[model samples]
Target: MDKIKGIAHKYGNNINTDIITPGKYMELSIEEMAKHAMEGVDPEFYSKVKEGDILVAENNFGSGSSRETAPQALKQAGIAIIIAKSYARIFYRNAINIGLAALELKEAEEILDRDELEVDMQAGTIFNLTQGKTYRFTPLPDRLLTMLEAGGLVAQLEQS
Candidate 1:
């Protein structure tokens, strides 16, 4: 399993895929779309995120459209993991298909923006590895954790 660490970007309810990667930018290259990624929600999103950063948000993450490009943009923008209260069905699958980690947690909003978090994919736990220590998330399922360990669903299926 991979251990990922990053600064959190806390968002509230109903964060759709469109906000994740706007439809207008769909025709653009992945690299281009990544530059404008999440621009709708946070104007400084792309600039704020660095390589290996994580996105920690609230309920209904990946709602709306079923474009795989949404997760692709995040991956291209260097997001290794996304922790949220829940995920839309298609977004969750697409994320895993592309080797991005999508973890479900009940208290994701408790994590503040820029909060340093360490995500242990194998252990399925998120720890506020920062000094403030404000938030922590419950472990993911063992089955899902195993898939993450294998580097997402495709790889997991290949292995099997």
Candidate 2:
């Protein structure tokens, strides 16, 4: 796939799943749930987000419940990718399973809100267009990359 370019929406550390998508909205469908994504942290989040936007956050992102709704909410809201210092194991897996690219990078905190980023998933490099700098992170494994490229696990399975 081609490189991903989008505006960044930065968040602080320990941003859990509950903040990503509150439990009250758990019963909602993916499209409905998206309207509530990040509502706990930013009441205007959904309104401000554009398709192909990127989310950048500090460590321990997605630390709460393992509900897949968090990632699904983000994907449905048109989040192209998420970059964090670290992600809760289940959240990381869920993101990829649902075709929302998530990356871990020590320099995640360096990214600022509204900064334009160009991410090369294959090279695992993030170029900050606003700051004229670049950061690197480990690329996803082949299997996960394949799944993400195919638009998540279900789509990948159907292809095979």
Candidate 3:
């Protein structure tokens, strides 16, 4: 499993698809779309995030729409992972399908903003060493883990 390290952007519940990757910028190119990713919620998002950074949000993430572009935009923007309290079913599936690591944690709100996190996908653990904390999550199934490790469904299929 890949190890993800980054500063967190913590937000509360109901962070929907539109806030993640807005519809108005969907028609743009990957580089262009990345510039607008998360612009709805955080205007400085694109400028603030570095490659391999992670986004941490509360429950109902990726709600409001089933658009695949939501995850695509984040991936393009160089987000390595997203750990949330809960995710919309379609968005969760889409995120996994596209190689973006996402985990559901029960105590998501407990994590502070800008808290540096180290996520171990294989171990199903998030190490918040900044504050001497560790959060555990339900591990993804072996098959799903395989897909995520191989860079999502299409890459997994291609490998087969």
> In model 3, where is the ten-residue run with the lowest total lDDT?
1-10
Can you write out model 3's per-residue Cα lDDT over 50-137, one digit (the tens) per residue? 7887888888999988988888888887788888999999999999999888899998888898889998888888999678899999
| Residue 80 in model 1: lDDT | 82
The reply for model 3, stretches above 4 Å from the true place, is none
TM-score of 3: 0.95
- Clashing residue pairs in candidate 2 (N, C-alpha, C atoms within 3 angstroms): none
Which ranges in model 1 have alpha carbons more than 4 Å from their true place?
A: 131-160
Winning model by TM-score = 2
User: Ten consecutive residues with minimal summed lDDT in candidate 2?
Assistant: 40-49
Q: Of models 1 and 2, which has the larger lDDT?
A: 2
Task: Estimate, for each residue in 1-160, the C-alpha lDDT of model 1 and write its tens digit.
Answer: 6678888777888889889899999999999999988888898888888898888888889999999999989989988899888888999999887778888888786788888888776666677876445344566677877776787788889999
Error of 1 at 34 (Å): 0.7
Clashing residue pairs in all predictions, respectively, total 0, 0, 0
What TM-score would each prediction reach against the true structure?
Answer: 0.86, 0.97, 0.95
User: What local distance difference test score does each model get?
Assistant: 0.83, 0.92, 0.87
RMSD of each: 2.3, 0.8, 1.1
